[model samples]
Target: MGRRVHWAGIGPNPLRRRVDRAEAWFAMVLTVAVVACGPVLVWRSGETAYDRAAAAADWQRNRFVPVHAVLLQDTGDFIPVYGEDGKAKAAVQAEWTAPDGTRRVGPVIPPAPGTAGTTVLIWTDSAGNPGERPDSDPMGAAIGVGLLIALLLVAVHAGVLLGVRWWLDRRRMAAWQQEWKDVEPRWSGRR
Candidate 1:
């Protein structure tokens, strides 16, 4: 029987459902994996890059730089700190768990573009090692999880759709075969 797998409405013509989604367990597993893994992959790579950039700079000249382009003032957080010299600079801070339980906090000078808010990024002078210089890839993580969820959904959807299409196509082809069979009988022994 000629049938095509349905995925995003794209299929091979004169198609055959070579693959069967009878178990559906595999589809579920893929969905779970995509939803679980996408964010980890995206965030980790981003964080690695951030670490590389952080390593390149001198910690003594600690400053706040956006990981992603965003406005600080708009977020309404005062930032940028200074040392005893009164020269605006970054400072090293104690690292520990924050009351927020969900996130950790550290001492920050809160530079001109400083804030605990995710909107503003905190930079550290290699020496300063501001607590804000977290290795956590929050943005990457968020995006990765989002993508993962989307992928999982897409995979499941594709499986469902393909199954339905396969069933329909099989039915239709069976009918056509039957019709052809009937026609053959009627035309038999005719000239």
Candidate 2:
């Protein structure tokens, strides 16, 4: 038959010290606190992230306008430029009609590599200035925030647990030192 494993300070035992009992109880309370608070933290973080993302998306949709621009020169024949997505692109002089019905020519980075006269879609502000693409995925942002919060919670819990264990070990060592001081004198017949 296998012997039952005994956890220190978990149950009544004559050998258990006060520090051990305190450590066990503290560990239990910390576990309960994590279990109770983890979901709430993740939910709140996710909600805040989603709200900000959605608001930004709405603002971008209303503020930016899409227009077709024609490339004035060939790309991919010179040094390649990379976009935020790490995709290869190039900045070339292109011409487009602005919202005010006036012709505008400027350096624009097309979404893909193309030759001269290739028409490509580009985003422009109300003043016809080129802008980066807006984020449209609020759900993705929420999920990412939720996951980050959850990871932080786990890290905090582990840190707290380690701190409490270190404190308890210090206390136990102090108590053991005091006990040894008392016993050593009698055992050596010096008291």
The candidate that wins on TM-score is 2
Per-residue accuracy of model 1 over 29-93 as CA lDDT, tens digit each: 65567568766765666565556555544342334332221232322333435555586654323
> Ten residues in a row with the worst lDDT in model 2?
1-10
**Which sections of candidate 1 miss by over 4 Å?**
1-134
Ten contiguous residues minimizing lDDT sum, candidate 1: 66-75
- lDDT of residue 75 for candidate 1: 22
lDDT of 2 by residue, 1-191 (tens): 12222453467676887677778788788888989988998999999999999998999988888999999988766687876778877788889987777888998888888999999988888888887767678999999999999999899989998998888888888888999999999999997
Best by lDDT: 2
Stretches > 4 Å off in candidate 2:
1-8
Would you list the C-alpha lDDT of every candidate in the order shown?
A: 0.48, 0.85
